[model samples]
Target: MTDSYRRQIDKLHDDVRRGRLSRRDFMIRSAAIVGAGALPVLPFGARAEEPASGGFMKLGLHNASQNDSLDPGTWSTSWTGASFNGGVFNNLVEILPDGSVAGDLAESWELDSGAKIWRFKLRPGVVFHNGKSLVAEDVRQSLLHHMKPDSTSGARAIVQQIETINADGPETVVITLTEGNADLAYLLSDYHLSIYPALDGGGIDMESGVGTGAFLLESFEPGIATRLKRNPNYHKNGKPYLDEVEFINIPDATARLNALLTGEVDFIQDLDIRNVSLVERSGDFAIVRTPSLRHFTFDMDTRVAPFDNPDVRLALKYALDRQDVIDKVFLGEGAIGNDNPVASIQKYHRDLPAREFSIAKAKDHLAKAGVDTLQIDLSVAENAFAGAIEAATLYQEHAAQAGININVVREAADGYWENVWRKKPFCAVDYFGRATVDWLFATSYVTGAPWNSGWSNAEFDALHKAARAETDEEKRGADYGKMQEILRDDGNVITVAFVSWRDAVSDRVGFGEVGGLMPLDNMRLCERWWLKS
Candidate 1:
């Protein structure tokens, strides 16, 4: 084979290893390059495992809050996502295990020539738990719920781009966008855009929690536990192998680990990296580490004093020893972040220069900011992530070397997302990461977005708008690359590391390839995983 052909094969292999491309896709592309007769033997576990049916599965998850709601727009934590959104409801599109978008509720979709209009054909014969047939109207109204002016949905910025949503008969829905967005389908796969039955009065009935998903909600108690049972009439054939699934909220890492150890739960997400060796030695459990776009951050409100100064923000970024945190807290299982949310595996990821840890540079930036010494309060909770408290303490020590006093405030985990994050000027936060760069930016960085940090720049906003509308691949990539640089240099959020999604599953459970976009197999464990018969 030619050297170029060999390089192409190598690239495909790398993509498969990183979970960015599916094994099936790799085989197809590789066979085309080398004739079918030259194909190599299939590796072990290459074939899909047949899913066994009928058993109970329970998951111990963290970050569940009392403020959790059945309303898709209000759902945030993994507790609600894994129990309700992933099992009890379905989005128009779904991100597959290989990080590709596939039809979920929508059987197929067509984009107009200008890329400004999209038409989705609903999957027929699909019915919600209440026996209501899935229709185009349900999709329109479900999305409209987040587009309302008064809506507080986290997906508001994403849906606001829709100029109109019209139902064409019972099965087809047309969406007109104010501007072209090539990533619209991926954005629709967002958990907050789950389809719900529409009310006769022109709004979606989100409070009911009824959806055309694989499982039905049996009982729910916010911040506590959610119980669900298999949907007898689920559209996905042979799915929801578990007879019942339970998602229990366990904020304490030690308690969650103990529950998994004692067989009280079949699986647990956000596995404490420190305990990986213990689980491995036990032989009763297996670790699923999927590299993801998930990043931990220390957000500073630019509207607040001291942080308002660009030099002060720069100083803080320089003071953070990202490698140290990744080594000590994450057990060196993650990649050091460049203050950018985009992961190296994703499209349009720019390989920006790594920001080195230099106390001298941090002190210099503080001097430039007209401050001899700096002091800041960093609010944190375990709910932010598995080792957020320890990460904060390490940050405090690192900052002290640069003449910065960081007061670490340990807050209660019950209402951390509601009470502390985005409310405090400086605090620790974590994002499960979105499927696309545009979706990630629209959700957390856009001006007027609900989850936006206090920093805003007209230039960055313009680039974002331009990039979203640009259909040219080369130009679009350049625009996105510029945006990453902008965030890295001037943004208020300090991204510490892009960590992998680590979860522990019982040996009794069986599954196929796992998704890396979010924890618990992209929060679809209940439907995709099954017990060993």
Candidate 2:
């Protein structure tokens, strides 16, 4: 009777094919009872428009560090994730533009009675770029690659719940989790969890660049560019309309915009919100704006000095004028954040009063922490977000009234993510966000996660665990709400603003709907876009 119930019915067709239930049984048990027959045919993004077939497409993006490679686990930013996933890799599952979960390598997945064990039926005929056939073992090995404690992939913590993985047959993979998690399907769609072929070493060959995606890797120059050509044998029919694709790194927003205007690139992402009007007025360009869960924050290392105090964290939260940051830094293109990772666009988002910008409240909390003065260093780079440095300066000015001095550290754009972010006691971070609440938490806020930014709360953790296993929609939503409340008042990170996935583009690029589920049209632009004549 709900959206999720409708989704379950959509998979009923797969259920019928897998011999799990007869047509009559499926119809009687859930389909007809949930009005599946009356459900409208809803497709994510543009599915009805006829796609044009040829042309070279190039994109200017803010991601791509010199540390990049063909390895999926080493992919840390938009450049690597987009280039690799959009071109050369495929996950077990994918989050479509409509925010629904669908099979990528896996044809269908079924849950056991306890919902703790899940079995996936691999889609036949899917093959790696190397011409090797995809099998259940490849899926299992790729998953295990992320589960190891030494794994540095962003998805490591998300998949840590897996207790065991078994290849039931050549086409079947069964995963048993330590606990019931209905959210596992969406979790598998994490960008860092790309499936790879198992090699003779009992592991995947990371540098091969062999994948089951629409493009084959051509050449990669770390921190410079990446070139790829279409994989003619792509599984999707009539896909990868473009013959070639390239991703160029332009860290400065101005440089990226200039490249598009100068005909050096076909599309450019992470356009500064201030330049939105300029791009829109340009006769040769079009604005590609997508409302998204993307949010930027200044992370405070809770394990470090001063920030270790809860009162200090609260004081800093009240010192910032979130509206000013949105109006000036974001150019009024984004909404104010509530100091939580779960954006308002997501499910289980809590509706609460905005944290006020008041020096009095800030001073009050500072006094409670027994600190007369707070001097904090904030690491920042424009690459962190559209106007990260400008926002930090504004925050510094406002905090002056509350007896707080913020020393903003400007780092090089090339290695901001690797050098400044989590390594610094206070720094800036931009989250492209996830399709679900649990994925967001696990990636950035879970205890000791690689990007945890040193935030940990026992109460929040307990509630998160409970919410993951809760089958009742209403109760699960309530559990997540309580978790948000804890984060709102006690969390270390200051979530300042949520912005649209705004990009400035030449008229050369054409696509159906540009999705905001992740950066660069949900990392599928390579397969979904074509060049305009």
Candidate 3:
């Protein structure tokens, strides 16, 4: 890692050590910047594009896949991320707007002296959409199910440190970890922790959306649309006031924008950068732009040639113009990345100087690594992003000067993740963050990790495990910082940019708030948001 980059990580470590960047600060900034504008219970005042007579809100989603699993633990992509937030489930601890821990199903919690053991006391009289009361046993069962093998839920790695999770009583749940978890509170606040009721047969159903969340599932058609209705028996009174909510899947970005413009749908997930100003000028819609944990980059398979050598990988990093990609493609919608996996969510975030972009540098490395005529297969999902086509075009233009022949291969939108990305030579992908260092490390970089990009480092894995085992906040931060250094130096991954999360809403829509860090984490809140009548 560069000395400059190292200093930034050290500075972040110092901030954490000095207590300047507390969880509360992170949450409040996230809430105001991310969760603001869409007032939950407050009125939206008056707007030009008024809603129809009765309270009805229609949400249009663009470029999100269908989530078949209601179990939050199994969520993988943005598709599942959206569904998890759509009232299919609830978690014991809720992460409020300000990054502080809040009570959701569990009203109160206490940590043991060393912070290794945590106890949660649930609130009584909370009922699931199915009219079943949420009890302590349900939390235990839901968490245990996630830890079991064959559970693809994202929380398996994060919760693996827990030695036991059992109900202390009807309203109390206890969690005994093998050691101290610095971010235990944040982990529980994750969207994946949304709990489910105990299943009748054997295990939790993978296809059903059953939970103790605010809204009840009214109708669902995979890859099409999901409709939810207010849960009258919800624990929070006067909530979910809106009679009903509908989430429509419009995968085409242009089509989705059109739907929102024509008043066919009240909201859309992401907006094209070029259209932001256009939408703002219309005065019919409101744009919610917030910095997010989302990171996008390209991966080179170490198992493949050209990228097999570290020098070759580093050369490719120097060859492509990241700023140009962001400027021309993202249209200045994001911050430049330093080819590091750790994103803004980490307390260790640092601003690194841009890597010099030169075609000569790319040619030198390719020549040193081998003969000539470098051929690489570039795989991209058809519906991956708004500017994917444009970005690929630019990459082709710049990389051609380096004598690199990129065979641009596009995958079918339907089965791209299953059939192509996992086993591709070169591909572009993005990942959102988990609150804790261990959670992100375990899922993204650990040995045998599903997202490792076929690159393995023993020292990197060791540092991550050591960080997870350490209880002291300072020591844990130091350990994770070391892992980031290893990743930065090795050039195993290229973090293109920390893209801002974008959403567009009509002025007529009364309650459409977007969370900063993980907006998809709370989709059910839409049920309570209504159009200004």
lDDT value for model 1: 0.85
Local accuracy of candidate 2 as per-residue lDDT tens digits, 1-533 = 56776777657634432223333455465635356445643222233346788888889998678877776776778888788977889988887766678998889999995789999999999989988999988988888887777888778877788999999989999999999888889988878888888987678878788899999989989999999999998888898899999999988888998999999998998877778778878889887666677888988999898999999999999999999988787766667787877877678988878888999999999999998889889999979887999999999999999999999989898888888878999998888888888777777776877678788999988888888888899999998888888888998889898777777777666778656778877788888888765
For 19-67, candidate 3 gives per-residue lDDT tens digits of 2343334345434533433422211111233324246677776544543
lDDT of 1 by residue, 194-282 (tens): 88899997888867778888888888898899899999998888898999998899988889899999999998888888788899797
By summed lDDT, which 10 consecutive residues of candidate 1 come out lowest?
39-48
Clashing residue pairs for model 3? 27-98, 27-99, 28-98, 34-516, 73-153, 74-153, 85-523, 90-194, 90-195, 339-495
Looking at model 2, the pairs that clash are: none
**Stretches of candidate 1 exceeding 4 Å from the true structure:** 1-48
Best by TM-score: 1
Report residue 399 deviation for candidate 2 (angstroms). 0.5
**Top candidate when judged by lDDT against the true structure:** 1
Ranking by TM-score: 1, 2, 3
- Clashes in each model (backbone N, CA, C under 3 Å)? 0, 0, 10
TM-score of 3: 0.84
Candidate 2 accuracy as lDDT: 0.82
